[model samples]
Target: MATRPTMPAAAATTSPDDLLRLDRQVCFALAVAARNVIALYRPVLEPLGLTHPQYLVMLALWERSPLTVREIGQLISLEPATLSPLLKRLESAGLVTRDRHPEDDRALAITLTERGRLLREQALQVPPRIVATLGMDVEELQALHASLSRVIAASTPAHQPRR
Candidate 1:
């Protein structure tokens, strides 16, 4: 089987008429890569009882707990409408608690539960597993991440993550 090319062979050389090709579309490439990469996290997260979105929320909390709903949304680039359900599910899972922020009664504060905190230990294995699964060099993945970050920033206005 032929290995996938790391990058396109000189997109600049492509004819103007090929501009409409699906293979040449950045949006198309990003869309498929995003879906496939997220899919790869499924089994890796299953043992921890977290979906990809939930895992992301947990990641944000692990770094710093007791964040407001809006704060978490901003950190994860999710809107309130989309984030609310994930928060609710996390709460129901007994992994986190959601309450009114101490200083701001209107904002919901999310804090990790004891179980959630302990889960972090198991979560530690996740990254290595994913890296092994991809069989990609750590440096290569880091480069890809940086490139993707740039794409995200360029696509988003004022670095406000677009969900």
Candidate 2:
């Protein structure tokens, strides 16, 4: 076998036109797919009086109750400013409660009410139900999830930027 010389690393630039191709842009496809997936959840979530972001907050709370507002924001990737209003809405709807943390006066902890805990039973079906509705079996869904998880893991930065 014969070996060929490697080109200089800096000589690998592609034309702007080529770079702009949709097939080459992973971010574009990911954005479109996320939008479409969220759209599918609209009807499912509407009857429960929850927006997608709210549903995400509920998910975190349901997994483990009594997380501080800042903890919830970190888990859901939302800012405190944005999460405050959502928490208020959930509070208004009688789903969650925001109270002062026992140990820290400045920190507010969020807890699920009885109603919120009950909501978790209903939401539990959401994952498998949504998967079944997509016409994919366990194996296919697992494969897709694994692939997307890899992509997300790679895309997320080690140190998130401060807001």
Candidate 3:
């Protein structure tokens, strides 16, 4: 078997390296965007007494009450291992409760508390502020969102359980 010849580092840079170029790598951009976006959310969420992850959990419960922990985990694209601590914190904060499911003895149901419901009213301001902080117009933001959604759909592992 013949070994392929290696290009010198200088030679590799002479050509337009599609691999290194920003536009060509969706994951690279997405990772950076996710980090920056989360950073933006941090300050916005502080006053609400929620972390970004907790805020997401609240959003899910606010939209639909009485989701099981497993159900919330699936809807939020989180594994039970990752969600357990967050739910524990939320429960401790008096925002949510975990109770045994009536029909399914094995699963635990998660319900938002009155405090959590009231928190939703305060949360209404968060999204608009996030959008404004992005400093991108609606069209740019929409296009970015749609493109990222497509990438997520294509790249996420298959056979994940649905809520």
* Number of the top TM-score candidate: 1
TM-score of 1: 0.88
Among residues 3 or more apart in sequence or in different chains, the pairs in candidate 3 whose N, CA or C atoms overlap within 3 Å are none
* Residue pairs with clashing backbones, model 2: none
Q: Please identify model 2 stretches exceeding 4 Å from their true place.
A: 1-16, 159-163
**lDDT at 1 for candidate 2?**
94
lDDT of 2: 0.87
Model 2 / residue 36 / CA error / Å: 0.5
Give TM-scores for every candidate, taking all chains together and pairing residue i with residue i: 0.88, 0.82, 0.83
Error of 1 at 137 (Å): 0.3
lDDT of 3 by residue, 1-163 (tens): 9999998686576666755777657677778879999999999999989999999999999999899988898788898889989999999999999999998999989999999999999999998999899888988889988987777777677834465
Give the winner by lDDT: 2 or 3. Answer: 3
Compared with the true structure, what per-residue lDDT tens digits does model 1 show for residues 1-163? 9986574567667777898899879889989988988999999999999999999999999999999989889988999999999999999999999998899999999999999999999999999999998899999999999998888788778867557
Error of 2 at 142 (Å): 2.1
User: How many steric clashes between backbone atoms does each model show?
Assistant: 0, 0, 0
Tens digit of per-residue lDDT, candidate 2, span 34-140: 89888888888887889899999999998988999899988988899999999999999999999999989999999999999888888877777677667778898
Clashes of 3: 0
